[model samples]
Target: MLETLLTHVASAAEATGETTEASGDIMSSLGIDWQMLAFQIIGFALIVFLLGKFVFPILLRSIDERNAKIEEGLKAAREAEDNATKAQSKIDDQLAEARREAKEIVATAKDEATAMLSKADEKAKQNAKHVLDQAHDEISKEVIAAKKALHNETLELVASATERVIGKTHSAKADKAVIAEALKGADK
Candidate 1:
């Protein structure tokens, strides 16, 4: 097609009586070849039509799908981040509550221990008092028994002395009078 167009141009130039050199010079200067230019324009238009019909739409759809996937991934990432934050908050709350409960348990245990200690002290004091009272009662009884034994020993000694001094056993009334007189003399 380019060769045929060039031949026609040469024929037209000859019919006008223009020399080949002059026509070549004019064509170079103008830089115009209408037929070749028209063909180039048609080829460019066909290529644009074919790309728009097939390749461009496919590329565009792929880009749109990729963008949608990216957006979905971003949304999922945001949701996961929010869930993590909520889980952390819940854990912190539970930890604080557990700490509070532990403290209360410790305090309650301390209180119970203190109360038990107080009760033990009071019971020990009561037991000590009871033992002391029992000891005092036993000591008083011992003192009374010792006094009775001493009195009986003194009466026997006086009766034996009176019988020895008088040289014979005395009447009961006489013994009683003599013993009373001796006890009075000892007091003086």
Candidate 2:
């Protein structure tokens, strides 16, 4: 190294046509070591080449595989979540339909019940009216029978009293006429 520095100094002095302490001082103050710099650059290149050829490819491949697996997992999770949401939506739609059907069924049942109740009330009213009419008819018949029985009894009593007063019995035809005339005057 010293020989190289001396040769560089001699060449520089020849070129400048002067020999100065300042030139040597300037070269030294720059603090550059050419051989060491070349060795450091070569070492750095070798380290870079080794890492790129051996270590970097392996690490990069592992990172790519990991990325692909993570992406696939994320896609599967999204699909599962979407399917769950769709299933829930379908269930909710079915539930809403069931509720609507239930409401319709309840309304139909209520309407049918109301109709049946109305019919029953109408039937009951008709039955009551029929019973009242029959009772009135029966009462009328009984009243007519009572009036005819009283008329017959009154006729018989009058006929027997006449027989006692006149000291004689009468023919059926004559008794009928006399009873009828007495009944007429009594009715007036």
Candidate 3:
């Protein structure tokens, strides 16, 4: 069966205008001799081992360093963002506090001004009352003086009329005594 298959394969190869070489000659011409192949394989294995052991490790270390630096930069950026947020919050709080303080100051000043105004009004009223009392006292004194003058004039007129009726010439001394007595009686 193997011979029949080989014959048929040969015929097929001839029909395709190609011939297959024997395995031994193919292997020898391709330099795939076991001993030489083994040496070549060992050399390639050594080169791969060296690259993996030294060069690859250095490359991985460099890649890791770059990654670490990138991560650190991201962390720093986050920290900066957080700090900025905190600063903004603090500024807002301070601004609000300032506004509150300003309002309180304004209110206090307004209250003080109102109190002062009220005090001024009270003082003005007191001063006006004092002035009115002094005016009343002065007017009362003037009225009393006028009434006393009128009473004296009435007595003088009566004395003159009585003298004319009796046809007596009254002396200055007598007139003075009479007026004095009349005034003393009216004093009661």
Model 3 TM-score, 2 decimals: 0.52
> Which candidate number would show the highest lDDT if scored against the true structure?
2
TM-score of each: 0.60, 0.62, 0.52
Residues 1-188, candidate 1: write the lDDT tens digits.
Answer: 64676576656555554444556567668997544554567557767877999999999999999999999999999999999999999999999999999999999999999999999999999999999999999999999999999999899989889779776657788989999999999999
lDDT of all the models against the reference? 0.82, 0.83, 0.82
**Residue 131 displacement (Å), model 2:** 1.7
lDDT of 2 at 168: 64
Q: How does residue 166 of candidate 3 score in lDDT?
A: 49
Decide which is better by TM-score, 2 or 3.
Answer: 2
The better candidate by lDDT, 1 or 2, is 2
Worst 10 residues of 2 by lDDT: 13-22
Model 2 TM:
0.62
| lDDT for each residue of candidate 3 in 127-173, tens digit (9 for 90 to 100) | 99999999999999999999999999999999989879646777788
Clashes of 1: 0
Quick one: best TM-score, which candidate? Answer: 2
Models sorted by TM-score, best on top? 2, 1, 3
